[model samples]
Target: MTWTFEEMDRMFHPRVVAVVGDKKDRDYMWLRSVSTLKGKVYSVQVNPEEAANIVAMGFPNYSSLLDIPEPVDYVIVAVPRHVAPRVLEDAIRKGVNGVMFFTAGFAETGEPEGIRLQQVLTDMARKARMKIVGPNCMGLFNPRWGLRHSPEQYYDDGGPVGFISQSGTHATFFSLVGYQHGVKISKSASMGNGIILHADDYLDYLGQDPQTQVIAMYLEGVPNARRLFHLMQEIGQRKPIVVWKGGQTSEGARAVQSHTASLAASTALWQAAVRQANALWADSFDETLDLVKALCFLKEPVGPRLGLVAMTGGQSVVITDAFAKAGLQVPLLTPRSYQELATFYSTIGGSYRNPMDMTPTSRNLDMVRRVLDILARDDNIDAICYEFNMGFSAREGMVERLVDLLGEFREAYPRPFLCVLSAVHREAEAVGVRQALAQRGVPAYPSFQRAGNAFRKVWDYYRERRERGATRPAPAPAGPVRPG
Candidate 1:
């Protein structure tokens, strides 16, 4: 059965969240930050000394989960591995529905005792009909709710893209990149070892989450292949799922085995999983994030017809080639759009064909805006792709001009607009400019190749959703789309 917003909402925005374990300085900060977003937090620790400072950070301190006066909706356990089962039992007796075990040293230790411990936890959870997030994991972070779980303080609030990663560092890095790259998080969880809750659980949750527009995963190997495949099939029908497996090489596979006690499984099985789930296999973290970001913003391109507009034909030719490599259609501009853009600038020496290159001409906001407007309005065009680089023309408020052009284009055109601002700019300026552009519903990337790849994914997602006769959840008026 498909999960709904009302159901999923309770999972993230729980009425009361109880955090178990002595609050270390780091863990306390993470807990406090997340508590700020929504919900009341009951800090549970055995030691009153440790809980004292944590209680001061805007949460009530309790000796144990059962001691909390209010009903705890979610519990995050960060105690020693040996102490976890007891704490989990307490949480269960207290009727906690969800628990995220952030402590490590279960199965990942590669000892028989560790494996046994994990199995015990799993068995207890199943018998209790309670859901466990992780036993050896970094845990989850939902920016919309102010969760920064790990020591990683990255925040990508209200973004449509959601991530599930095996690596804690990957979880932290990707979230940082999502913040840096203009991608937002609906909800992100790092399932370090699939002791109890596997990737499939979070995948299923994100599939049903109203805030999540697209899903991305950094998988080492599938924990429960059968369940994952079924979940993927169902989730893929509604939204795009991009996965980047880490254990590809023999050495990498060995690392994954030791890191998470994850079996690499057969290559054939992995390949089949990709196809069966209808999931896109991304090559790297950048590609995974780029594609997810694209899917979050752009709609399906009508056809392969990509209308490329750049400051120069060289840039256009480069983007066209990248588009082809990314399996995108590079449709030539129709006569109407071509003629409309022609009124604004000279074509110089190059042919005035599709990748409309307004080269050697003064690069002004009106010139770029008119080109984007005309191309986006074209009946033959499916989407508009443009490139802008700093130092090429930074004078005369170039950033402001680009931002204004993006604003006007969004107002005039209804199709997806993919922009590539490949150069490095000041962080403050870039953030302001990007925020402005994103406000108008445009998706921007750091490079032309990335822009092309993003557009391709967006097109695929749009097509996939259309084929399934599904509609995207109505996104709230937020910069990043968050699944409710």
Candidate 2:
């Protein structure tokens, strides 16, 4: 069934929810899930006396939606698949709008009985005009509400980065890494066994969500390719959507089918889908996560005008080649700008050009400042990429000083700035330097190649979008494909 923004908003942002499943003795576990839900938690299981412990722990648990005196908006079903159908039917009968099915043994199990059972539930919900999230899903996490939907043990209402992953492990990994990188998430959902709800359903909902500024998707396959593309096209024009399509090979496709009962559409079809939608496609998990983090934090940069600021001449040369390999252009600094930078480095001694190398003498704050000030004023450049090294010198607060200088430069003239710090010294020192750079709106990568690759992804996406006009209609809906 298709969904609009208004429905999801009212359903997710509910005042009270009923968690229907085996009641956990762990106080407030259901309440904790409800607490994380961005609304009041109410338990609707078999037992009432045990549910009070959840309310005492700050989450209201109820026995049933019908039994509860107050109106219930959402239901979380964590029972077995066989029983899930009954629970769902009960919720629908009670007039609940949304249901998060955390049960397994659906279509993914390759059992006809399970598939038919799921179909029965889906048919019932559609007939009743109610929205169902997943039959074999991990559930939803709203960081803002501290609603931790998964059993993986993550809590917090994250920032504006909305993540939708087909795999629960990937979702958990995303949460862990995002927290580590200081990238807060607004909403995260691990949608398993998409019986009725598809990825596009979530994307469309987020399109209208004020809290979801960027969309990051991890998909094994899409059920409604046309709808997914349309949603992606709509979302991409406004906010960046980064996608990592798994199941590239035949074996992998089978695995994805087993994992989520997805169609595992061909790689060629996915490539066309992404290109037509004007969405950014990442090859690996690292690339996918990096693109998402970068897009979420850094400003969208136009064109490939990349300026490299290097702490050493040798590293500068290395980065210049890396940039070329990554399809990045190093526009030569305008002669006027070069001379201005020259004047700043005349005492320290270094040539001025793109990949602007400040020699050993110019390694101090004043030299870095002069070069940054000159580049900041130039309109030819669109992004600034810099490299730093952590060694004996940085322990003397060299990294801190540079971070402050860069921060000041960003404040004075805002643009997409990146830092690639060489981890030649201790990991702690490298982390300190990376964190410092990140604190100023600059994304820090460990290697020049990584920085270059990320810049390439950004630049390639920009160019592709420009060439294709980025508003093409989505491909037509596709029927199920046979296994090869």
lDDT of 2 by residue, 1-484 (tens): 7777788777657777778763554433445555555456666656566655555565545556677676778787877677877787778778887888877888898999988988888888888888877777766767555566644444543466788888877876777666544455667778887666678888888777877777788999887888889888877887778889989999999999888888888998898888777788888878876776576545556767788877667888998899778887888877789677655465344556777776664457776777777887787888888676665244466767777887677656667777777777477666555545655656677678877888778767766766766642221111111110
Off by over 4 Å in 2: 22-30, 36-38, 45-63, 150-158, 331-363, 377-381, 390-401, 423-439, 467-484
lDDT of 1 at 225: 78
lDDT of 1 by residue, 1-484 (tens): 2234554456667677777774676557546545555667777776777867776776677787777887887788888888888988997899886788888888888998888888889888888877777777767777766656754454435677789999888887887766665676778888888666678777878887877877889988875778888888788776778888888888888998888888887656776787667777787888887777666566455666788876666787888888889898777667876677667567565445777676755366666666666776777788777776655557877777767667677656767777776566644556555555666666677778888777776677566666767656343233643322
Q: Report the alpha-carbon TM-score of model 1 versus the true structure.
A: 0.86
Report the CA-based lDDT of candidate 1 relative to the real structure.
0.72
TM-score of each: 0.86, 0.84
Residue 307 lDDT in model 2?
A: 85
Top candidate, metric TM-score: 1
Regions of model 1 farther than 4 Å from truth: 1-9, 24-27, 47-49, 55-58, 150-157, 329-344, 347-351, 377-380, 425-428, 457-484
